[model samples]
Target: MPEKKQKKRPGGMDLDQKAYQGIRQMLFFNEILPGQKIKYQDLADKIGVSITPVIHALKRLEFKNVVSHAPNRGYFVNETSLKEITEIYDTRLLLEVSLVPEIIRHLDAESMDRLGKAFDAYREAVKEENYYNRLMTDMRFHLTIASMAQCQIQLKILQELFDTLLLKYTRNLILLGIMDSSLDEHVHIVKSLTDRDMDGLRQALSTHLDHVRNHITDGFRKMFAVKPRQMVDLFSLQ
Candidate 1:
């Protein structure tokens, strides 16, 4: 006898997921902006959904530390700070470098092919001047290596960390006119991985990440110095 297929819930769960993704994108691209309080109705209206799904989405984001809720006030985008940036990159470096050996040991022809394809796509995106697409492709390249490491916990953390920092940091690097050099660093890391030289891979990865950290720190300094009022207005955004 054939097994019966269970019916899936229509609209409700799907709407919630859609709302979550919509709100997440807004947060990622600074559409909502950091430290801005988000209203449920406004989000629902923007997402073309009802308040229920929006609330559900906000709850999920809150759980992920992407958003925060208050007793009386509504949801606010999690503010990014230099201290948080430092901690995130520090943790990323520790976990990512630790995974290098495992990734190299387990890397296969198929994994190499995937990495090569992602890197090529990234290079093309960079040439096209599509910064967002280039950033995503670059992320795909690193996450592909992380996938090869087979550490689910570490992979999850890395993904979250990148999600929080990738856009802001990439934009800063692009503004600094060093995005091309960063791409070259990526090329070196890929070369090391392909050669199965763990030491080279570690050094390349460390150099790339350290550059990112320094750029982010410098960017933040310049941003705050130029727009000091923006920092003070964070809590006032509604």
Candidate 2:
């Protein structure tokens, strides 16, 4: 049977949310590449939604730095930048490392269970051989650790950072062959958590993130070297 290309909507999902997830799926599948100017009608047509919801979704994405807006230029997908992504990594390290103590302090049976399950999910997801699944499970694993800190603001910031980093650099993740080492790093993190070793936890996380950051930034250097501000349509190129 041929697989359906259309997205299935969850019950009770509003158009705005459906549009958001639809666009995100496009991004994950590489249907929407960076440096592409997103047309509201085109996005809406792809998602089977009205232009209004796509506009709202793009506005939200603009706030996350996933897209950029201009006075009359509509929205263009932001190209990857080594400098900006490196800053994101440094900022994330500062925030996540600082939250280690609180994560440890607030550790309880429920939290520990969540962390363990999240790790397990990531480990098992690797076997599924789906990039999007791996990316999402990998993200959930880290976010699970941060969620234990009980800090909503930092958690939100971290989520947005992950969103930008993972989505914008999806190409790097696919080509870097970094996921091979990620499971081992995730295991080290879980071990530190189980032992309640704050310093060790920080080390594991720092090393893991640093490795990912380095690989991605290195991979994207060539990308930025020739990156166009906006990707023009093939039809327009003529």
Best by lDDT: 2
lDDT of 2 by residue, 1-238 (tens): 9994544457868888899988887886678888898989988888889998898888888888888997788888897677887898788878888899999999999999998888888877788776656877888988999999999999999998888866677665655434478889988999999999999999998998888777777766754564355323321332
Error of 1 at 87 (Å): 1.4
What does the lDDT read for residue 133 in candidate 1?
80
| Alpha-carbon TM-score of each model against the true structure | 0.84, 0.81
Stretches of candidate 1 off by over 4 Å are 1-13, 166-178, 228-238
- lDDT by candidate, in order shown: 0.77, 0.81
Over the full model, what C-alpha lDDT does candidate 1 score relative to the true structure? 0.77
Q: Write the per-residue lDDT of candidate 1 for residues 1-238, one digit (tens) a residue.
A: 9995432246445777888888877766667866778888888899888898889888987877777898788888776677877788788778889999889889999988888898999889988887678768877888888888989999999998887775234443344434448888988999898789999999998998888777767776766676657744642442
Candidate 2: deviation at residue 199, Å? 1.8
lDDT of 2: 0.81
* Model 2 stretches with alpha carbons more than 4 Å out: 1-12, 177-179, 222-238
lDDT of 1 at 11: 48
lDDT, model 1, position 132: 70
